[model samples]
Target chain A: MTADDGFDETLFELALRMGDNALILGQRVSAWCGHAPVLEEDIAMANVGLDLIGQTKLWLGLAGEIEGKGRSADDLAFLRADRAFRNCLLVEQPNVDYAHTLMRQYLFDAWHLPMLTALKQSAEPRVAEIAEKSAKEAAYHLERSSDLVIRLGDGSVESHERMQAALNALWPFTGEFVAPDDVDKAAASRGLGPDLSAIAERYNETTAAVLRDATLSAPADAPVRKGGKEGLHSEHLGYLLSEMQWLQRSHPGAQW
Target chain B: MTAAGTLPSEKDIWRWLEDVPDPEIPVVSVVDLGIVRDVAVDKGGAVVTVTPTYSGCPATAVIAMEIETALRKKGLDPVRLETRLSPAWTTDWISDEGRSKLKEYGIAPPVQGTSCAGAMKQANATVACPRCGSENTEEISRFGSTPCKASWRCRDCLEPFDHFKSF
Candidate 1:
């Protein structure tokens, strides 16, 4: 494909994948806005969620820009139907317990930090710029989430059990993150993305260390699910999109 | 309006902006916050490009308005403000002079370093205590009065201070 063929389809698809992850994770985290176990934690989670939403806006906006469509970030986020989103199933999972939330964050942050670090050197300047800015925020989120996992994993018997369960439950979804697709291969070859296979190694080391410090055992190897990077998502995405798009679909360009 | 060859210069416009303090941190001017990335004149009017300290920072709107107000007061009727997020705002963009001014005004400036360092390194970085000029300060909380700052307390002065976290 020629560079002038408009926005690179592969790049646009990659941007959507990145944007979807942020959007779905932001939605899941936002659910804890008023229900956090502690006030400080409530605010912290909400703040982190807001930061992710801001990131989603930027990435999604770039996606729209690449597509050369008239759609704005808001339109893409709230108007898109299910099966169109490219986010991993892990992000779309419901926020069941505080332990679940922390586990999800820890798992995702471990991968995100390295991914952004690599993207900072992307051939595309805009992608590199966004990655540079976002890497800093992701680092902080990873630190806080890692600390939480350790605390809960080593806490009272009941808390330790709960966190361990959370870790085990979410482990199955972790494989989907590093399962590369053709789009990912294309971007990686161009120096615009990370080699997920390599990232998986770093992710394993970091996550294992955190788990060990928390007195939790890492889950054994499991068959990984695939296709999220290609617009194939889990059942949860349909419900999420339905709720998120209700207002936008009903109103159709209605602005506040 | 001044005659074609007799108009005031860019320095005059910058001097006029001296009174425009940052909305969130009143001690420092918008220019000092490093938000004012560029200032130039176009055919229509004066154009100023600003990068917010963070995305969704509430102070952004107020800063834009203040810039417009300040320019209008200086007889620049047509002032345009643009916000850019591409390069992303870093606390390193803040000038050393601005850091000193923040200290003098009772606000701790952001510490210098790359964000890849873990939280422990971030917390241990020397942030001069706003009150007693002590280096024996500890971060009390990562989240502070606003999204941009962290609360710290000095071992010597025993007073809590807000350290603007580097974005």
Candidate 2:
């Protein structure tokens, strides 16, 4: 839903991208609530999910305001179809295994931390405010995820192989993080958001260092897979939406 | 014991708020945790400003309701609660008394001097054990039971404890 009709469509799209990314990933992480490999890890995953969900409120709340459609964060999150979501494909990838889940989180956190750090200096005050608060949490998330990546990637043969395979499978989806389209270009030109290319450069350096430390090798010049930003998602997103929106869709206005 | 028709002074309101315990950490008051940023009372009503310690802290709403209820019990009608995001809450804001209370309650207080901006960089910062008073503590996990805490264990006593995170 591009904000045509004279509204700041760039801001709306950028906010939606940020909000949707967090919402989808948060939902995925929250799925591990009672099913983690260990008790401590279960608690940790849930905490991360909670933090991301909390951030979704801030980002989507701003999106709704810019859209001027009287939509709240809940309405945007629970009611939107897969085609309406603006999150990158990386986050929407299924958590195939614990290693895959950790890799996905590490990859997203690597981009997310730098993205939020730059947004702290956003031209929009509301965006900057949310970024300031969110950056701290993102930093913590990155620290934990990167640490796990290093540990598991360098662990025993089985664990190392698992981590390596997960990295290879998820690597292609990361291209969308830095791949700029018209919306990203407009947002950067207007100074409403950070330049995706600059953030991409930082993302490469960060992920490279972490992968090196983890003893994991990524495919060089891997084919870039994109399109989630423009809402063309994988089959996985539809399943994710069905489960996440079931309660709200089945019985509208349901609340605890 | 304020006189009828006379609003309690801000100092008095602050004092009464000290008795309102945090829902999660009942041993410490919200004021002790630095959640209540400001309080003002006028003839119209009372307004209390609060900042959530974590973006996803579930206790935020409950803390607001508790504050309003505590104020209402004091005969302060038409109380208003405001949420402020700037000057994001930090463990540094936690009062000295809060730190001591947390320690006594078996949760290690955050190490002083760690800036919230550089929180992620201070991953290896030393945290003393509240159980055995040992400085040899190892972090079990960065994410703890609550958003503001981390799980740490003392080498000497070998007892697991929660450390109030620096951010």
Q: Write the per-residue lDDT of candidate 2 for residues A103-175, one digit (tens) a residue.
A: 9999999999999888888888889888888888998888889999999999999999999999999999998
lDDT string, candidate 1, B78-151, tens digits: 89988776677777777787888888877788876543346347466677898899999887766666667777
- TM-score of every prediction relative to native: 0.89, 0.96
The prediction achieving the highest TM-score against the true structure is 2
lDDT of 1 at A109: 93
lDDT of 2 by residue, B1-167 (tens): 25576668899899989999999999999999998999998674689999888788899889999999999888888889998877677788889999999999999998776846454355557888998898898989887889888898999999999988887
Against the correct fold, how does model 1 do in TM-score? 0.89
Q: In candidate 1 chain B, where is summed lDDT lowest over 10 consecutive residues? A: B113-122
The recovered share of true contacts, given per candidate in order, is 0.28, 0.57
- Across residues A63-146, which tens digit of lDDT does each residue of candidate 1 receive? 998888788889889988777888988898878899999999999999988888888888888788778777777887888899
